[model samples]
Target: MYGRILKVYPGSLAEELELVPGDKLLEINGTRLRDIIDVSFAFADEEIEMLVEHEDGQQEVYEFDKDYDEELGVE
Candidate 1:
């Protein structure tokens, strides 16, 4: 599950999630993400796992657990 961060809205949902522009999404709950549709569907769950790649070539994994309908605060 991988997609590049195309854009981020100022003071929007994505900003609160720390999803910065130029970051590359690598996976969701250990599952590979193919596109925007996959990311939308995968984030529907209460718990999610993600892999993010920074422009410096550093990769980090994150786990987020929240209310099912909680907005991801993403762009």
Candidate 2:
């Protein structure tokens, strides 16, 4: 499963994750992602892995390890 990002907050923690508007979310951890709710629950873990598609057609994988309940300020 996958979801496309429609918008992003400027200067938010999402920027630090290198997420941009229009990026295609491919996966979370090793599981397929479907929507925002899926993303929300998936990120509840202390560690996460994400596959993203860039506007220029580049695909990237990012991993994050943080405290539980920490918000990335993304939307």
Candidate 3:
């Protein structure tokens, strides 16, 4: 199971990672996501390891080192 990305805000971390709508978010920091609530909790960390499945069916992992208060800007 995965969370589908709907939008990536410009000038945000999602955009910086090149994520787009239709991308499937699989996990954050190795924890599987079951709902939006999980996403919220998982995103609180300064270090993130995200696994995403692109529209092309290719899966990739993205790592980010950010401010503890930074947002990813995806909906």
- Separate clash counts for every candidate: 6, 0, 0
Model 2 ranges off by over 4 Å: none
| Candidate 2, residue 36: how far the Cα is off, in Å | 2.0
User: What's the best-to-worst order under lDDT?
Assistant: 3, 2, 1
- C-alpha local distance difference test of each model: 0.78, 0.79, 0.93
Which tens-of-lDDT digit does each residue in 1-75 have in candidate 2? 677877667776578887877888888787788777888888788887888888899999999897788765655
lDDT of 1 by residue, 1-75 (tens): 468887877775457667888888888787788888888888888887878898889998878686777665554
Q: What's the C-alpha lDDT at position 7 in model 2?
A: 69
Judged by TM-score, which candidate is best?
3
The residue pairs that clash in candidate 3, if any, are: none
Angstrom error at residue 41, model 3: 0.5
The alpha-carbon lDDT assigned to residue 56 of candidate 2 equals 95
**lDDT accuracy of residue 27 in candidate 2:** 82
- Each candidate structure's TM-score, on Cα atoms with residue i matched to residue i, is 0.78, 0.81, 0.95
Best by lDDT: 3
TM-score of 3: 0.95
